[model samples]
Target chain A: MQQIINFIIRNKNFLLFLLLFLLALVFTIQSHSYHKSKFVNSANFVSGGVYNSVNNISEYLHLKSQNQLLTEENNRLRNLLFNSNVNADSTFIDTTKFGLAYKFYSASIIKNSYTTKDNILLINKGEKDSIKQDYGVISSKGVIGIIDKTSNRFATVISILNTTNKISAQLKKSNHFGTLTWNGQNPATVQLIDIPVNAKVTVGDTIITSGRSSIFPKNIGIGVVKDFEKDVAENFYEINISLFNDMTNLEHVYIIENVHKQEINNLLDE
Target chain B: MNSSLILNISRFIMLVLAQVIIFNNVNFYGYINPYIYILFIAFFPVRDNRLTLIFVSFLIGLTIDMFLDSGGMHAAASVFIAYMRPLLLRWSFGTLYEHQTIRFTTIDFGPKISYLILLTFAHHLVLFTLEFFSISKTILILQKTLFCGIFTVILSIILSIIFSRKTK
Candidate 1:
């Protein structure tokens, strides 16, 4: 006991400094914006590089499953190319037939965060690759997010799972449009608001982007209606949609840029 | 002796007030920010309790950080210099540090300049590095550290000389 007290007295300054230093460090990290911290940037660089290498290895490991998926996609494309001509009235609207109003840019998701109220996904493409804010991003399965911000070599996306994100969507069966939003509770489920009570909606009905906004083209698959209930106003239906893409497992994504966005926006302004 | 302690405490408050309210707003160049508030940690009485010195330095730094919203950079740098003051004083003033309080006014001309410059430089370097927290902007970091250090060193020396007690 005597020795411990002597030691404390002897090096009290160092101990005090250490304690205060830790408090200051915690304050620093807690107060600093995640993007503002150069620590986060360097950490992103290091982690991005590591994830790239790990993805490369895992890509090799999952070759069989990936190849099967690719083959299935290829077969679907071939079918579309051949049968699309004969069955012009098919439910699927081949994008190639839609002129040059929309362009698709391929990007790989480097970081995905779905556990927060305002979750964001970081992609490898950025402004240098012609990506801009408000660009709609989707995977082969379904819609993922919209581009929020871009640096030189990277872009961040506001994911569909985010509470603040609202995408315009409609039912494929009834064509009744509503505002899609996330409840921040389930990654697999999102809610559609302002759907009029009169709309004929049933469980498992397909939901898709309405093309009302210039962000996404019409008929982009969103999900299936899982459940719905009357809102507080008793006029609109609060629909629950089960997302098709497992947001947590996304690896590759396609950014959709509507080239006519500005022209349409300008017309609306007038 | 009690008067001197009161004077030191008052000086600490005055310097912190000046730093946050006045000097912090003086953004001369794009990157150069003069941290003259570190004067409190730089010239604290040498024979004072080391633990008290560190705690006091922390309080001063924390006060400045709260005003500036700088996320504890000032506090971290202040504690660092407070801890290093003893070793730096022994290095700069040799035996003089062992016998007497390191008041800027009573110190010799040569040792005073060395002590002021070294501590000012150390404080500025740590402050800027923590504020930036990145190694990629090496040139920008060095540019900021050197310019701010030079500006702070000049201001601190001039202020200390002006405030130094007259020797008989």
Candidate 2:
């Protein structure tokens, strides 16, 4: 009994080290996917607030450009209203929510980086502005990215040019949708794969979001196909798309909150 | 136990805050982040027991891993450096190793500079390799190692020169 006690005393520090290491290792291994997602969510909640305040300062600096964009959009909307024929019986105009079918909240870019294995953008909008994961983000030029995480006043976005970003996009002419991915070699170009070999994929065909995504509305402009080829697999086609928006020069952006997102999510769950 | 002990703790806190809040966010050329936090562990007083030193190093790495979401790569690396530091220090400085306090500022200039540079390089090599996890991309790994190490060594030397008590 005494010998066992002595041995324990002598090895106490070593045992303590082993214990701490085991705890860390267990946390690494048993970190449940659900639990890890929760942790990431909370982290986003906290960091988002800090980013929003910092971005608010910059938003003040770019008020002029933003006003110009709003004016241009107003002019375009007025042009459409005057040209369309009125159907008095029905209030529905049958286009992208008709009266600005989506809510647009302006936010400034606080921290943005394009050169990484996974490119993430930090913007100054959060839960306070009704922003949530899966909302599509865009600048005046075109689609930017999708929100990945949200805090009270800030959110992180998965840029369209990120290697990890895969959104459903389709050819403008045929209504065929394929998976759009980035190759990480270039920021201006994104790769579209899984177009059926049968797709009438000619070079320079306009590509747009299929609206198959609950996050993004149908037919938002993404880019035009620059090049395409069949892979050795013979099952799918690889396409290069040239983006309309310059990701590197982004400043002001809008966060889109989809009204029917929860209903769609519940359906998917079921 | 001493003023140096209090100063060291404060430095540790400052280094960790700087790493998490500032340096981690800086991407000068995209992927060339400077890890100046490890300097806290590298310059711990030489008088500590080898076992205690290793444990402290492990804790340092664990703290970083938790924040950076690096799984276990940093933990594995820091423990290895802690284990090897004593042997490396003795071999590099010979009789100077017997001293209780490390007076890096007054030390023989050539050996002191070489020691700091070598250990800093060694730590970075272990870290980036485990991060990429392959013999492939050897060229990229070499590029990261040399540039980051040179940057870190320059910073550490500047710090040690200003702070080292031996210079007085």
lDDT of 1 by residue, B36-142 (tens): 88888877767778888999988888776644445577788889899999888998998877877555566788888788888988887777777656587567667
Structure candidate 2, residue pairs in collision: A211-A218
Those runs of model 1 whose alpha carbons end farther than 4 Å from true positions after fitting are: A1-54, A61-65, A86-99, B1-168
Error of 2 at B138 (Å): 5.2
TM-score of each: 0.51, 0.72
Per-residue lDDT value at A242 in model 1: 93
Compared with the true structure, model 1 gives a TM-score of 0.51
Model 1: docking quality category: incorrect
Docking class of 2: acceptable
What DockQ was computed for model 2?
Answer: 0.25
**Candidate 2: tens digits of C-alpha lDDT, residues A1-270:** 999999878876566556555554444342222113322221253345444555466567567866886687679778988888876578676776465545777887676566444456777777888878888898766689888767677677778866557789889999778898887657788899989988899888899888887777777788888988999999888999999776765677877777777777899999
lDDT of 1 by residue, A138-168 (tens): 9877899888657676777778976668889
